[model samples]
Target: MNGCLTDWPGFCRQLQYTGERRLLVLSGEESWAQQQAQALLALSAATSTLWLGDAPAGQPHSPTGKYHTALGREYQHLVFNAFSGLHPDALGASAGALTAGGVLLLLCPPLKLWPGFADPDLRRYVALPEQAAGLTSRFITRFIRIQQADRHVLSWQQGTPFPTLSLPAGTLWQGQQDNRGCLNPQQRHALAVMLHSARTHTPVVLTADRGRGKSSLLGRLAARLLRAGKRIVLTAPNPGAAAQAQAHCPVPLPFIAPDTLLKAPPPADLVLVDEAAAIPVPMLLTLARRHCCVFASTEHGYEGTGLGFALKFQPALAALHPHWRKLHMNMPARWSSTDPLEPLLFRLLALNASPPAPPPAGELNIQWISRQQLLNNDTLLLQVFGLLILAHYQTRPGDLRQLLDAPGMSLAVVFRQRTPVAAALLQREGALEQTLADAIWRGQRRPRGHLLPQSLAFHGGQAQACQFSYERIMRIVVHPDSQKTGIGSQLVHWLKHNTQADFLGTSFGASPDLLAFWHHNRFKLVRTGLAADGVSGLPAAMMLWPLTTAAQTVLPVWQGSFAADLQDEGRNMPGDLPHPVPRVNEQQDRQRAHDLAFYHRDWHADRPALRRFVHRQPPCPSLDEQQQRLLQAALIPGADPVVLAREFGHAGQKSVISALRRIMQCYF
Candidate 1:
């Protein structure tokens, strides 16, 4: 287009002829990149094109379709500018929108210097405003290496000649077109599997990368099932994802959100779950147990990777239905298998990333590693980041930038040989000036990256806590295979003993098992957020471990305030109830048994005249083990009465109910 690369038309033609997607990297000055993109657009034969980032005026540009909005959309060609800093989520998402024989033209700085260049997105992860100016990331360096290894990627500099296009050897179309309108063999196979599942009342799992037509296959299967006189229900994390599958079905099909479906199910012959990974594992398990369901999810998606779903939910599904079948769609519905952009996106986002194989069975070595050291070692960085990704649901490209560039952040790892089996991310907090501390205490200022101090001063009413230095353990991850082996606890112990901070603290979505783990580490609950977290739909609990005498002086005040707040909130509820006891392990269970035995003995002697005591009562502290078991079974949601009877050696549901009533009478 700029007269330095005249083979552009020929290269585009070859890509279309082979039905392959190719990446055209226009790397040079901003003007050069824009000029090449404009020229390519004029010469190419793409029918539908979408421009991302800042592009030439009068072009079909997507204003809001940067990273996450590209799903459920399709295009024949795309031109993405990385001048504003490359967003990995945007790049991965837009690449999936390209049709077969399309071209993804990327505009960026020269490949060799791109990694070291200042990225604008680094500002979002900078610990301090001063650190934003001199930040760099190893993620970009690794991304450049991946691009260099891909031969199909065409790079254009200031004055280089356009390279000749070389196509990979393979027939793009693998099988004859079926009457069901499937474009490829993979889609055909998926359709057949869905049909069989509907007829046999078996659950099926469908997994594929984006743009694999899995959504469309689901729609066709729904239509076929409906025509066969079967009622079908479609669901997803959001209504829009479910709509993708429903759009292809001719007949009306009801779509429900995953949570609603789990809470109250309607009559249906089969249930189709789209984007299964985005739905919580608990909800998916409920659907699997209650209905014959077909689950469809992208292998690695911008919404989030399905690796966790495969690791945690698949076993549960198998336990519920051993005959369930799995189908994988390997062929891309919109592009060729050899598309260089696919693998590049995968590596850049660490979407398909898995932790390093567990260190050869032995004792793990735990130590703190500097950010510079991690940047210097590519293998170690990948292993550490991969474990972090697996440990949390919200890990993203921005986190990688922080891991490398944040000045106040540090990493600790437990290694087996050279492989990282467990890791923790810690951030320094507090040490705020008097002015800033006063503002935080008054809820006038809330700064980024200082979660522990700000939360304690404003929410927990511990303004003095903000004056002392602290370290917040942001995340602690142990390899799935190494869990329950004390790796996580050992990591926390190492941090507490090694650091000079006045306190060690953490905040996370509350759950029984997680609370037990923190309690066992000697961390006491100090505060709970008023609102539930959007992701887990559960309240967040903040726990603290005092490291100095100054911190110990303020601990009792915070604890008393937290306890009062918990009681007040419970009283405000409709039932004027008390909060449930935190579920800890065998020691607490035994204590509860002892307390309940005392309550049973005193109930008749100390019986109160007012019924108010019965209505506002907390769990019976003196119940026996059997009574506690019966109460738990009756009160917990989804607990089957028949199963409880069998498990607890009761005669039947009648005996189980009788025991539960007797326990309730003692409390009343």
Candidate 2:
């Protein structure tokens, strides 16, 4: 192949003739870059092509698709325009979409200054205007260096000759006759495992990097099972993920949402969960218990960290099904094993990254590192950020920008020698101006990034809390291997002792285990959102720890208000609502129980009693377990008497009413 701008057509022809994938790097003026891309697209005999980022006039293209949408799609050619700034995620995702005999063309500014150029995506990193310019990320710099060093990657400049093509030998792997539609040997093995597991009703887990054909394997397995008269239920975090498998299968496969499957499980011989790591572990556990299940997840996915899933979920699976089997697919289904972009993307996004090794069974050295220091140290940054990615279910590329550029954010990490075993990201909160604080309290204004202050003022009804300076623990993660070893507590204690903030607080989706962890750290639940979180489908809980007299003064008010709201909202809950905080004292519990019984029977007469019950705590003897159950059911704003009766082993609603009356007599 000739090496020049005009030679792109010849290069494309050679790539197509060989039936092998190649990456074309075009660097120069934007206009010339587009022209080169156009020439390649015209010459390449691709059935389908996608152009990401802006395209020249008369060019058919789609805007850059977010990395999460990469599943269930393939293309013969992909063009990524990096002039406006390179989106690491889009680059990673678009690379995976190319079929075995395809090409990925990346158009960027001159490679020398590409890293330092102002990126449109940088706007997401900084809050203040001054931090925008002269803010170059090292990740981009490293990416450019990698591109320059690789000889296999074809690079083209404006007036310079295009490098001669060094096409690798061998046609794209088309699977064996018995494994049609499977692109490679690894995928064929995975298909066999899945089919065998389905037939024997043995639980199986499929793990692979992105584009390993795990989803497609599931689809093929489902089709085979369905033909044999076995019902297959397919699910994922969303319908789009499930659709990936459905699209690949020749026959229609019954699909259900993750939550729906958990609530009312349909009859099936096998339940296949695609992107299983993205779905909550609790839901996955429920499905595993009810049906023979198969889970497919990317080993290091853009959607969620499979490392975290393996750490947390694998143990539960072991306990649930002792005979369960796991299969790992290593070969790429869409591209060759030697593709340079794979390693580049993994390092850039820390997709396959792991946290530092655990300390040698000893005390950890904790340190508070400034954001600038973290950014300057590439190895440390990866270790810290990788730990965070493994800890959270929804870490995205935007979070990396925030970590490097966001103001009022601080990082602390516990090191075992040179390895970071645990880390925390803290954000300064509260300290709002009086006007802004009052407006927030009155629901007239909302601010970005001030989660604690805004949530307290508006949601908890603590108007003055916005004025008090506080520290919000944004995220804290201990290495899975080192958890329950007190490293997390040590980090928290270090923050409290070192910082002069008036208080400390944190919030997260409420779960029994998570709530207990916060409570163990001495944080009191101050508020709980009525609506379940859109992502986790669980209610959010906010907890606070007072460190000063001023903070102490407001803590009780917030706690009391939260309790009252919980009493009112629990009734509408579908099932039993876990108490957000510790239960009240015996005296308060008795008074609350009495008021709830009266309110349940006749609210008009007991309205005044309810008011007194919330406002004051009086002296009284402790109530029995039955009395406590009555109080919980009756105080729940819309609790059904019949449901309460059944829950408490009563004969009927009449029996529940009689039991409530007996409990109320002592209070009266």
Summing lDDT over every window of 10 consecutive residues in candidate 2, give the lowest-scoring window: 600-609
**Mind giving the per-residue lDDT tens digits that candidate 2 earns over 30-54?**
8899988887787665678878878
Candidate 2, pairs of clashing residues: 3-162, 4-162
For 428-506, candidate 1 gives per-residue lDDT tens digits of: 8888889877766654566666777777665554547678887888888998988888889999989888887888989
- Can you give the lDDT of residue 351 in candidate 2? 65
RMSD of 1: 12.2
Ten consecutive residues with minimal summed lDDT in candidate 1?
602-611
Q: What is the lDDT of residue 404 in candidate 1?
A: 75
Which structure among the candidates has the greatest TM-score? 1
What candidate 1 gets wrong by more than 4 Å, as runs, is: 4-6, 63-66, 111-113, 116-118, 127-131, 159-176, 183-186, 200-203, 229-271, 279-293, 304-326, 433-446, 571-668
